[model samples]
Target: MNFIDLFAGASGMSEGFINAGFVPVSHIEMDKYACDSIRTRAVYHYLKENDKEDYYNDYLKGNISREELYEHAPKQILDSVLNIEINDKSIKSIFEKIDKRLGDKEIDLIIGGPPCQAYSILGRHQENIENDPRNKLYIQYGRFLKKYQPRAFVFENVPGLLSAQKGQHFKNLKTYFRKMGYEVYHDKLNSADYGVLQARKRIIIVGWRKDNDHGFPAIEKIKRKFTVNDCFQDLPKLKPGEALKVTPYSLNKNEYLEKYELRNGVDFVTQHIARPHNERDLNIYKTAIKKWNRERVRIKYPDLPSHLKTHKNESSFIDRFKVVDGKGVSHTVVAHIAKDGHHYIHPDIKQCRSISVREAARLQSFPDNFFFEGPRTAAFKQIGNAVPPLMASAIANKMREYLCQI
Candidate 1:
């Protein structure tokens, strides 16, 4: 069956559905960089169109100064202006194209994780208010459901979505979707239970169309936890800065970066290049590593934090990136790992070195053959933010069982 992935960032959700044997018919994304990483069945062309138009207008129109354009331009005139110019299409036309593709054939599901950070409980706490403009994007998702009338839909977001302000917003969301003729279930699910080897808990909202008699599946208990040893026990090991000859299992560097030139011969950068740290910084990193080792020993022998009790090998305090066992399942991968290597350390050594791109991918449960095609940070972000393909596949199987009851 076919499915449309909306707000598809790097196709993490799409990867899950594909693993579950569903075909992705289209994807809607605005970020050019992220779009480059995952091939889209379809994309919202309007964003690129407007951006191109805006660039050309800004550069070619010598008649209008930038300051004058910014200050004196009428609101109506600005509204008419395309940010990226392409006259070939609009959003409505794109949706129509999708509808044409869906004609006669049945699509089993529609899935996405719209940028829901604005409404996230963490965002609310940090921002000190609930005025995130992104919060309203769910309305757009709702509008899509009303229009397409898919058999089922899944909305994924941070766990904070369920606990934010005692879930008033979540209540409203359920009521609205229920009003739209769907029986919806929203709960936080731990990725580790589904072989992610991470402690991440995301809020997943699964729903069936009102016309359908499908009942939601009960959450099943997984007898075993996916561990670092389960995932990477078989891949060939590579040391820091050691580039492997173009292998079937490697990923290419991102095409959007200007700093590193990708020659035709070399497909990927082996690891993140490092710079020399000052003496004091080096000392601090050493101390952090020592402290981390001590913590690990203590946890293994005695009282341990709940988060670390079951994940002793994955708990590298210096930077969690290190694979404690070089040939084992990886620890929980987080988005912030891209910004700093503080959470990841080399699995083989105790130095404060960051994990290689390949190592990071393994940690996120990406198959060795699955490549990321953006800048380093973008690649890491994609890995960090994605739903582990294995975990997603398990969830999809459950969804199928849930739909069978209809």
Candidate 2:
């Protein structure tokens, strides 16, 4: 049950596996901010597990800073994040500590995805398709497979990975793993199908050692569909530029909300701060909402109120400002939100602002108790880049069930 997480951005995949009863010996990430978030999570895990109730109480009362809590975290967990490339000599430290942390157990699982921009189909054209250096990071993953030889591994990336090079890249990827003695099952999995409200389509590759017979888990259609409303409806409404640092979540138990509840039983949520919008964008949001309500459906660009049709690039950015209908599955939450959230305008016209970091996190299926540590934009980047914890939980559950039998 011991695992190593690579390319562990904010430890989203690690969170899911750990929640499913797997133990992580180390989480390797390169970004300092992301590593801090993962380390903070480890601190929370330590506090919760070691029965340090008073420390948490002190934290809430502002008697001790978050830095003080880190002092109490186990060194093994604090060292969990190595902010360096996998090939760097720094990786030696993780190998040095693995035996001490895991004892007699071999590494059972390896989970993560490489940086995906070069493999994304949308960002490529004829000249740059094969020239992206990030495309070579798969070799780093393969290196881990050869060294650790885990019982199973999970690799995630954008769906475009399938078509990266006229299908040759995918074929070669499978062939390489097969040579490593793994039976691989690779496919595009939509997060919405696995209970995440966001319609994120990621390529998930699950591999088992040749001797194991576990096929990928069955995909079942959900009876009760989750939507933008289901995820964000309960949050307090906000106007442009308004922000609330902390607010209480209304306790409501539904299958969806249960997965997103605060695990520590904390009543308040942090990072609910909203971003300010210029007058031009606010007017556009107002028009988008007013027009959509009137039409009771999607509002085309040409039909937008004339005053809002000032942009010259109508055809290219036609529906640039989108208001997600609360009743429908949310549009994919992408890292572009870090630059500007115009692509994901709040569904509520009264708010008249872009989606906040916390709202984006909700759409991404991060648990209410989990905190992203950084600037607001950094938080958005972390959430946008993460795997939805609930969706990841489903995958880990199936993987664990099979691993136990083996």
Candidate 3:
């Protein structure tokens, strides 16, 4: 099956679909750094298929530049990543480019959702958010469905999308998709239910042609037997301001890492680096970690000593400083982590810092071999915004099964 990914942030959704044996027609994304990431991922897939993974490993080890890696990959593979924004002015050209890529093939699926910020609960608090331009990106998504008329589509977004504008936006979305000749079914799904270590809930809408008999795919829940510690146990520990781009594993393989392919037989790890923290924040982290370790209680920002308190808006967002629970699934990883790590502090007090890039990726179910392009902040933004590949692969497998029958 062939599919086109829209708003393909870091190609997480694309990775899952590819892992399920679906071929990507093209990936459309606006951010330059994200586009580069998608291209790099495409190179990885292409090299792996041709038994040239050594080239990719070299890139990870900093032995070769990204340009050199791209030089080895075919032009079509690199060109499959479209670094253009989707809007009225660009949709036509976008369609032309995708059509060229498609050639004689048809798109079996259309996957991806618009930026979720406009519909997110936090975003709704902003003034005039209803008029936010991002809210209208769905119209562009509808346009693609209308043009391609694929057999099915998967729309993924934050759960806040269900209640956006008092459910009016969702109603309009269903109506719009219906007009495009799709029968839509939706449910709120937790990533943990699909094998991701983080308990992130998202709104997943599956739509098929109105003429088809298929309904939403029944994705079964997975019982988790491991905690976030399983994801963290093998990586080398780091203090604040420390970094290790490519380092050998600190420990042997464990059940969670082996079962989920997070380790993926990679001999080395990259981006296991931590952000620098001030003495004040480190002290606060110590308090938070001590509280959680001893009493299993999260230390709220308001509970901090007067010297530790920084933000004045104490009435809300009081639990701003948080520790990643090593005993269980983590809280939702958000793009805000790029701006600061207060909400994603590491559980180990010895580190006295926020989680590293590789650690964050592990929480999101990204494999060890998957190298994120661009700087640390950009990588975090991509990871936080991505659809966890483990969950996406499950969803994609279900979609493929349903498509095959019809």
- Candidate 1, which ten residues in sequence have the lowest lDDT sum? 256-265
Off by over 4 Å in 3: none
Sort by TM-score, best first: 3, 2, 1
TM-score of each predicted structure versus truth: 0.69, 0.91, 0.99
Candidate 2 residue lDDT tens string, 1-406: 8788988998888888988999888888888788888887888777888988567555644578878877887677787677776654655665665556667777899999988877765567547668776776777787778878899999999988888888888898888988888899987888888777888899999989888858776656455566777778667787777767666765454555765562346666667878888887788788777766666565567766677677666675566777766677788888778888777887777777888888888888787667788788888888888988878888898888889999
Error of 1 at 392 (Å): 0.8
Tens digits of per-residue lDDT for model 3 on 133-173?
Answer: 99888889999999999999999999988898899999999
For candidate 2, report its TM-score. Answer: 0.91
Residue 68 of model 2: what lDDT? 89
Winning candidate number (lDDT): 3
How many steric overlaps does candidate 3 have? 0
User: Residues 322-347, candidate 1, lDDT per residue (tens digit)?
Assistant: 32433333455767666766456554
* Candidate maximizing TM-score: 3
- Candidates 1 and 2 compared: the better one by lDDT is 2
Each candidate: what lDDT?
Answer: 0.56, 0.78, 0.92
Total clashing residue pairs per candidate?
Answer: 25, 0, 0
